[model samples]
Target: MKKRWIVLDGSNIMHWKGNGADLATVREVTRRLGEMGYVPCVVFDANAGYKLNNRYQDDAELAKRLGLPSARVLVVAKGTIADEIILSAARDQNARIVTNDRFRDWADQHPEVEEEGHLVRGGYRSGRLWLNLPDEAP
Candidate 1:
């Protein structure tokens, strides 16, 4: 079976704990997404490391933490946000984005996000992960 490509909003997902940035949460999400048969590519803002570890985290380091190759983990340039990169990656890959954001701000620019199942939203409930995605990956 061919695995579909999918994008993850690392900057947003790292904060899933509601306390501070958590790399474990990101890893868990990545693992679950992969188990669902999607190739998960994560994009993070420049300061993700600082928020999570109070230090800089390059793509290689983050990728190692997520058990993915550096190429699949992108840390955008300083002052650059990850939203556009994440959305663009999803568009280019023709894959859905796993994020809680509706991308309403970019609705005019990224109209594809409005399509059904374009964004796979999910979160941890009592330590269990649940994603609202189609049973079959496209």
Candidate 2:
């Protein structure tokens, strides 16, 4: 069996619903990743905790409810660039990125992204989330 490691761009998917990135979308993506036989590790930008706050909950409260394990989610430090972090992790682990972001700014840093299978891009469509992976063609 092949190992399928996926590095998810957490902030991007949280905002995929048009309102904001939320726990629901994150869970949905996680579930789908598992169903597809992929092991996922989600990465978030600094201050991602703050952005989760809505009318009913704060960061800590939401975190408790979210119950994500430490190993599964990673948050970059303040002032650090998330793209670099995401790219580095993917490269080291030989994983693909799961995000709609084109990462055009980091083309020089991650040249492999331009090649097929380096990035898994997708978005919401017709009330459902859709991800596009590279085709298995030589």
Tens-place lDDT digits, model 2, residues 1-138: 987888888878888888875878877877777778888878777777778763334334433454545676777777888889889899988999988888989999789889786888776778887777643211
- The lDDT of model 1 is 0.88
**Which prediction has the highest lDDT against the true structure?**
1
lDDT of 1 by residue, 1-138 (tens): 766998999888887767788989899989988887889999999999999889999999999988999999999999886888988999888989888889999889999988989988887678777778886432
Which 10 consecutive residues of model 1 have the lowest summed lDDT?
129-138
Score candidate 2 by TM-score against the native: 0.83
List the lowest-lDDT window of 10 residues for candidate 2. 54-63
**Model 1 residue 64 distance off true place after TM-score fit, in angstroms:** 0.8
What is the number of backbone collisions in each predicted candidate, taken in the order shown? 0, 2
CA RMSD of each candidate after superposition: 2.3, 3.8
